[model samples]
Target: MSTTERPRILVVGGGYVGLYAAKRIMKKMRYGEATVTVVDPRSYMTYQPFLPEVAAGSISPRHVVVPLRRVLPKAEVLTGRVTTIDQDRKVAVVTPLVGEAYELPFDYLVIALGAVSRTFPIPGLAEQGIGMKGVEEGIGLRNHVLEQLDKAESTTDENVRRKALTFVFVGGGFAGAETIGEVEDMARDAAKYYSTIKREDMRFILVDAADKILPEVGPKLGTWGKEHLESRGIEIYLNTSMDSCVDGHVVLKNGLEVDSNTIVWTAGVKPNPALARYGLPLGPRGHVDTAPTLQVQGTDYIWAAGDNAQVPDVASRKAGVENAWCPPNAQHALRQAKVLGDNVVSGMRGFPQKEYEHSNKGAVAGLGLHKGVAMIVMGKMKIKLKGRLAWYMHRGYHGMAMPTWNRKIRVFADWTLGMFLKREVVALGALETPREEFYEAAKPAPAPAAAAAPAQKAKAS
Candidate 1:
């Protein structure tokens, strides 16, 4: 912990890329050889793939995120953001959660600033769009959906009930499809307890601009997924764009209109725009340009990876493809971090660096319980699965890949208990405004019911 002459390794983010990179560097380097410091806005790293389950109350939000300090004890985990990086002086402008901003000098830098939700100028998107990127959004989406159910149950107006029961999800990718599928499952289970609302009463709609959903799983499975979901009463709109969602009245390019209280935007994600301020060469889409060795192009002491780095895909290059790059998925990010970290260590010791080359194993997605899709590639054989088997593969793969044994066991335990117990249906809408009820109680009332009745009788008399 001494601010001595140790080489300072500054990791600009603590997400999947940065956290694992820092952990690897700390493990490979000897004590006092380098001072590894990780800076991020959040103190915990959210396991994003499990976000849909978090939204559906399958996994506790806490269990899905790992505390940075707990996981990276040897590394200095700072809860803050790097506003700017001065590469010339090798110092980064750190903006902590509180207090004045300061500069942290670095001998080596790792830019793993992950992406943000890609949004557009679509009206009401900024105001009404619910995201599925983080634990908060996942929890909020759960609460919002269930609150809609509460509105449907308590309201007598047909318009109000319909609006509350109408759930519109824009985007048919993993986030959109998995989210709607899981939430619909939760809603179906929940409807059994409602007096007026039935499973068929709620309208679930999925819209996407893409011609197909889950392109990672190929066209056949994507079509099957769409058909299976539709058979379950879920509506799918393909090759459609959202015109506007102003006032929760959704208007689509296909001439469809729905007054939905819930609008989940899982369209896509773009690289973090913060890279523009870092003085690093960025790709056309705003990702840092990284070499195959995982080092930032034209820089020896600095490296980048994950969703923010446009690292060339070796597998694609081998196929004689031009301008191929590693994808921004968890699979590549996790592997790239290890390669990037080792390269940083090698560069420190003036050793030759190894290039990062990885072909995707496959993709797995869960559509609620006992319903899923997967495409696993082993050698030349392509394995495609569906139904319950695919769902189990989806869970098993993500459960094992959920980082550290601490998280892996917890996630597996959740699944084990989930089989024997029902999904939790409690919606904590009060979390956003925990003190609202108390504040309302303390405020002076316009008139009590008794006082109002007596005054009315006196005036009438």
Candidate 2:
């Protein structure tokens, strides 16, 4: 029988869930038992946890992303978006990068659409706010931050220098705190290369509406992280939020205002709104509703697990917690994907499905090169660490957790090389628009006669 004649497993969204789930399903299923198709807008899966390192120039952007086609050679990978799902027809509408939409029939479906950066309608935010949700944004932020230093070092005007030197970051979560910490460390090092710029000349402000930062690491470590950042001459504004960043003039809800050219927004994320079109049962917060078995509620053949699925925390419930849901993090997403993929294969073979259950394994947050906080939880015991030790834990966990030995080795190599080599602080901002220079040099030259005509006309007059 041709490939189309076999049962099809459709996995949507090539993120943490989609990549791992497809890998597991391919490994477990018998040869010729089914065909697996993974569809996503990008051809690679970005390991989001390393985004801060990418932004800080610690890890090469290429190392953090895994090419889908290369890794899943046995499965069919489509670079596109699944626009709609018609459950009644068991068909999904796929719109490729450059083609007409087509219907793909499938016997089983996996929804791992993931989440997008959540934003608000504050004035001028759409124009000035930068996000840290993807690899591109992380790279852009790195260059943008460095370019600000260049602007400050070369400009003579005090106001311009001040505006260029002021960097404002909103949200005190891991993304925000870690980004600011890494960036501040970068800027401090970068300042040594400038004659006029010093660490004191640059201002790093971290603002959040919450009472503390790094809430994932517990309160004690959170407080320690805050105090540590403050000791570095960085400004911390808690219990406050940004009101406006109109034209780079940042105004806060607490009535503080400052002019800054760089404003990063890393508040949080929401489930991909596209989930609405799939006609699946969604939870109160727009996440796909799923049972503990990692299968979508009311649907036997459909499964979802990731940031986009509201899967009950069976482990938490088993520990006597009520209404506990798995938090959307790499720890949970990675584990759930394996279970989800196995369940998919079992369901196909008419076997029993295993319920997904995993308790919190604590959390780790790296503040900068040698600074971090961690909380390790094991069977009713919680151990906390701070400073260099915590930083090592943060790196060690993420390094091993990185998908595939290929990526894990590359990432660890980068860290190892960093130990021997001087920190690379150069900003390749031009990478953002690599063609602009070529276009300037290669565009057709203006006609000499046309250029002279204006002067000739003046002389004639």
Go through the candidates in order and give the clash count of each.
0, 0
For each candidate in turn, give its C-alpha RMSD to the true structure in angstroms: 4.3, 2.5
Spell out the clash pairs found in candidate 1.
none
TM-scores of the models, in the order given: 0.95, 0.96
- Candidate 1 positional error at 86, Å: 0.5
Q: Global lDDT for candidate 2?
A: 0.94
Candidate with the greatest lDDT versus the true structure: 2
The model with the greatest TM-score is 2
Residue-level lDDT of model 2, residues 1-461, one tens digit each, is: 12488999999999999999999999999999999999999999999989999988889999999999999999999999999999999999999999799989999999999999888998989999999989998899989988999999899899999999999999999999999998898888888888899999999999999999999998999999999999998899999999999999999989999999999999988999999999999999999999999999999999999999999999899889999999999999999999999999999999999999998999999998999999999989999999999999999999999998999999999999988987777889899789999999999987799788999899999
Q: After TM-score superposition, what is the CA distance of residue 254 in candidate 2 from its true location, in Å?
A: 0.7
lDDT of 1 by residue, 1-461 (tens): 24647889999999999989998998899777889999999998999999999999899888899999999988888888999999899999999999999988999999998999999999988888998888999999999888999999999999999999999999899889999999999899888878999988999999999999888789989998999899999999999989999999999999999999999999999999989999999888998998999888899999999999999999989988899998789999899999999998999999999999998898999998889999999977889999999999999988887879999989888888999998888899999999999999999979988889989999999
Reference-based TM-score, model 1:
0.95
